[model samples]
Target: MEHKILGVIGGMGPKATSVFFDKVVEKTEAHKDQDHIDMVILNHATIPDRTSVILEKNEKMFITAIKKDIELLEAAKVDHIAIPCNTSHYFYEDLQKMTDIDIIHMVDETVKKIVETYGANCKVGIMATSGTISSGIYDKSATKFNIDLSVPNQTLQDQIMKIIYNDIKNDLTADTNEIEAIIHDFIFKQNCSCVILACTEFSCIKLSEEIQSYCIDAMDVLVERSIELSGKQLKSLQQNKSNAAII
Candidate 1:
């Protein structure tokens, strides 16, 4: 059987792109290499910083670069496209209009999963770039689903930006304390039922198991959707099926 092709528009930060690719491969349930999904990956590492473009209110350069990627994917005959960058979803509608093929909405899929897993009344905390937060991408989706949101204040948000850009993006070690403290506040103080690791950069780090329970990684959601949409079974799902049969 021919598996559907998945097009990836990546390199918002190179590490995040690598992790996303690894997750797709690791999570896919394939008996052999032939069973794996075919992919077209464009590591557009030089694409401008998404947060800066949104804050600067000048998106022409970012749009132009990504548009080319879309056209290329369309020509490649990809069944669907997955952009692992959460901040780039700020320009989602325009990006979608640029191609007939579907570009998986990472933000929307994350929010929907949160509601389905935790229920609509749950308060969600967002940990993302200033651009994604300021653009109201999560807020818009949460409101539509009738879920409450708890975002980091200016100071906390600044710390997150430093970790994302100053540290992770630069290949320096990050101080994971900032991430822990923010998650603590959201879950304990703000009474958020769950916190979203909304930025792809967060996926590149290791969070403690305790901290992870109260958080959802948006990248993981995107990965699951990408694999399924590309006509592959998730490894986790395949395992569950095997266990059920044994029972």
Candidate 2:
């Protein structure tokens, strides 16, 4: 059987990309290696932190790094590609013009699913990087999909920033008490139906089964997409089976 290959442009946070791949495998309904999608992961950790450079006004370096990886994936001739970072999507138009390959939009895809599964006008909390918030990626996507977005107050946004950058990325969760409390306030007290873990770094969290009851982690949503788009489904190949030996 011919295998369909997927090219993943990852390593925006380095580890988030790795975890996303693991999720593709875990979510695949396939029962064997042959049933999985073939993929090439360009774990280009050298790429600068996308959110930092965007929020900090440093651009050329990240643009160059991303272009190099996109070129590599194009050379590999993979069927589809996706970057798991939401904030980095501000650069999607630039990348799209640069490559012929399909670039799946995490922001767009996640919003479509959220509305279809959640509702058309439900209130949602966003827990993305400052850059993601600043760029208005989620807000735009949500508006396009007709979901109302409510953001935490500035003080709470700061607390979220610390938990994502300082706590998760820096391995300083023990000292993130202030941020954890803020998360609780945004979800429980605010009556947010769902909170989008808009930053990929938040994927490293161990969501309290309590939080899991309401919020959907962003990375997990991307992985589910990777699996669905992988072209590995037996149902996808059913038409080709008509040529099989007569039974």
Candidate 3:
């Protein structure tokens, strides 16, 4: 089978890009080597802070960075493309207009899956970047399917952003257990069916074996959906290639 390469416009911070790739590999149902989708990881760290740009309403630097990445991915002739950064998706329309490669909407697919697996009105606690919150990306996703959306209070929101920017983004694993416990509290106390990891960095702190058991990782679904839509076969993922090859 011909290998289909999926392009990643990443490096809003390298950690999240790495996590996204790991999940993409893990989510692949490949049983053989050739069945996995090849990837082009363009770690364009030159893109400025999306949260600040969005909040500050300064997109020139961010837009330029995205266009550079889009142009790079298109020139690489990748079969499809996905942006790992959640906040950067705010410029999806702008980049999509410039690129010929299909741009997969990662959050939209996660929301659709949530609605299908849970229910239309499922209560979900969102953990995301400030930009993502301000942009109402998750809110938009929830509203599309009539799902209930809740975010951390202003204080907690600021704390979450710090954890993401300071701890995860900087590659320093700050103890987010206390913060995550509060999130866990919301899941049970507030009667949320699950929590949504709206920020890519939040995925890192979610490494707790306990938290992993509770929160649903929207990133996994996004990657799996990208693979499916990218026309990648199910056999060539770096791991389990032999087992999934038959598929």
Q: Using lDDT as the measure, which candidate wins?
A: 1
Top TM-score hit? 1
Clashes of 1: 0
What order do candidates take by lDDT, descending?
1, 3, 2
Model 2: colliding residue pairs: none
For candidate 2, report its TM-score. 0.87
Q: In model 1, what is the error at residue 154, expressed in angstroms?
A: 0.8
The TM-score ranking, best first, is 1, 3, 2
Q: Report the lDDT tens digits of candidate 2 across residue range 163-189.
A: 777767776243434535556776778
**Residue-level error in angstroms, candidate 3, position 90:** 1.3
lDDT of 1 by residue, 102-209 (tens): 999999899999999999878988889999999999999998888998888898899888988888888846778777888999999999999999999999988787
TM-score of 3: 0.88
